[model samples]
Target: MNKREDISGFYERIHYLAPERIGADKPHINVFERASCIGAVPFSRRDYYKVTLILGTGRLDYANQSIYIDRPALVFSNPLIPYNWNPDSSDQHGWFCIFNQAFIQQREGLLNHLPMFQIDADKVFFPDADSVDEIAAFFKAMMRENTESYVHKDDILRNYLHLIIHHALKMQPARDYDRDLNAAARITNLFLALLNRQFPVDSRQHELQLRSAKDFAKQLSLHTNHLNRMVKEFTGKTTTEHIAARILLEAHDLLLHTDWPISEIGYRLGFQYPGYFNSFYKKHAGTTPNEVRKQAV
Candidate 1:
């Protein structure tokens, strides 16, 4: 099977709804008892908007990175990005709540008001056992109450969930920084998010819908070289490096798990030719596609 077919077996549910169906209006809370093979199941960003909390004893893979959650920890994603999970072990227990962007962006002051949960996507916030227990209990209660035929339960649940998010944010690390550094980092983050949304296009052979760092900078109304400098200073890498990394990751996935021919894989990833794709992969990955498949086995 091809790359797309390889991921077909994975389970994907967005906000109690699929990703395509999720919007500002829908909100949902779900609890999961992880089976031994939860991560083995592959799915796309089209499945869920974000992962509120991953409450399992096993390890997980997100955004092509591996994270081991020993205790209950928080994880989230922007709507534009796609991610996957690889559970280290089969037995895991935890609960997760999925909400639409409208829920979090309730109003102008809401997001800034709760900095803990929104603390950069690359950061993970861990609370004390007591805090984790409290939050977990809140989710459990809301999950149960949501099923009841009570009036205005949706509104009540939303409030309770918001409270949980705020309470969790309290555990975020305290960062002491000058205003310039903070502002620069925030700006870089916005650009990065915009970049992630246009990637892994459904049709790779065509000229990409979005390309070049300058275009992103233009979209965000920032100077091209200035955006480049800010990202490099903040992330310790050039803007091109980040974009290439994302492309390479998708290329790697197609190479390893999918049976798509080299040309088709290249086209799906925005490469005009199979040879260019191979060279690009070799440059960053230091090996050919076949070598990666060999290592996987």
Candidate 2:
């Protein structure tokens, strides 16, 4: 499994010449307008949410679907999925913003309830030329606001982000399924919520608690068999498979991004022994931890 990229790492890789303070402290919101900086590297899975408004043609790959962008489009990305853009033209022009959930924490139920940010919802929206211009104007305003020395700049920026969400919602089609109305769907959503809450492992001290299907089932108050059935019916994958996949992703990130020893990484990931961790990584990733680290170097 390839390492999942985090927000800070992404900033460093893309803005190599920029000062670290440029990307620091605004854990909730970061915005960019120049396409050259963003398109410098193709991104894999990332551990934050993204909203991109593209003004040119490109190819977008998200999860299992590949979309060819011929017109202006609004795209959304979340931590749960992996996506990348392959621009058909070098004239890529757009504005994009990356944010963590904490950035909009006070906007109760805004992101969690919005279909545009949902894990299983359609993430792409093709807008009319007029709408594209309207959205572009908003981005221009945000860029201008970002340069000002106002005291409440963050508050203003948050409002701008919310406005973009509302504009996209007006253009998006209605969802085909309502997970809120179905028991199985609700359970599956809750299960995924529990799974996502343990991510972006920032420190060796922050160990994962729910390491197995049984552990998650216990947390959700469901039998292990019931949990597995619901997960398979909804996502076409077993509960254990989902847990293992997420664990592997975190392992990859830790190996490449941190200098933690292999034993400490194994312990943090819930392995009792280094040998067990090695076996698990080799079996699934087809390489050892040291090799992954060396290749990253």
Candidate 3:
């Protein structure tokens, strides 16, 4: 898997116009009208969360499922999964806004509680025409306020986002997976959350603490075997497999996006030596880190 595209790269790819900055670093929220933007890029995984309202025909490929959209629909995307949208026609009309996890982290237990944003919940909603107009109005309002000079703009936008989420909640249930909701399921969800929390490796100084199944098991307060059994039972993959996959995904992304040397990338990913990192990457990625960087060039 490619490293998920970050906000700056996403803005650059879509040729964003007059981006409104909430801070000196990456902006927490970005809104755009689908029609005025350039042609849609080929589908790929995104690193941030997105809420999109498409008013035209299209096909949405989300994970292993495929949904065809002949009517207006609301789509929710999170960083934990990969998805892509294919418009059937050239005249696509809609609104989409992308925001990082920090934008929604202001309210405690907010993102985790939202059904639409849940990792295994239903992410796509087809709304009635009236509902489409209502939701589109909200996006339009957000776009307008994004350019305003209000001190409370961020607060106001967060409220709008919450309103949209609530509206979706009332529309229809999106969850299709028969979640266990048992102790095992809860543990698996927590383990995955802890695993995901240590992601994107924002800084070279940011060392990854949980690098192995044993490390995660310790953090989750479970014996290593119990942790592995819970994760494997819930996700159908061993705990180590999940950890290695995520680490390799990050390595690929860093290799392609950053100028960090192979040794540094290896160290940042918790490898003790460059040779060990090279062999690990080759075992999982079928190529050395240097080869991956060279291929990207």
Residue 229 displacement in candidate 2 (angstroms): 13
Model 1 residue 196 lDDT? 60
lDDT of 3 at 263: 95
- Quickly count the clashes in candidate 3: 1
Report the error of model 1 at residue 95, Å: 1.5
Per-model TM-score, in order, reads: 0.65, 0.63, 0.63
- Give the per-residue lDDT digits (tens) of candidate 2, residues 101-196: 666454653566566675556789987888888888888888888778787887788788778887887775554445666777778878978987
**Model 3 RMSD to the real structure?**
6.5
What lDDT would each prediction earn against the true structure?
A: 0.59, 0.76, 0.77
Where is model 1 more than 4 Å wrong at Cα? 1-41, 52-56, 62-65, 68-73, 77-92, 101-127, 148-172, 176-190, 203-207, 218-222, 233-236, 273-275, 294-297
Cα deviation at 49, candidate 2, in Å, is 1.7
Candidate number achieving the greatest TM-score relative to the actual structure: 1
Worst 10 residues of 1 by lDDT: 6-15
Query: 181-251 in candidate 3: lDDT tens per residue?
Result: 57677788788789878876757786789999999999988999999998888768898988898788778
Per-residue lDDT tens digits for candidate 1, residues 187-288, read: 876776676665545454434544578877888898989999988987678888887887777677656655667678777776778899889889998888
Q: Considering TM-score, which of the candidate structures 1 and 3 is the better prediction for this target?
A: 1
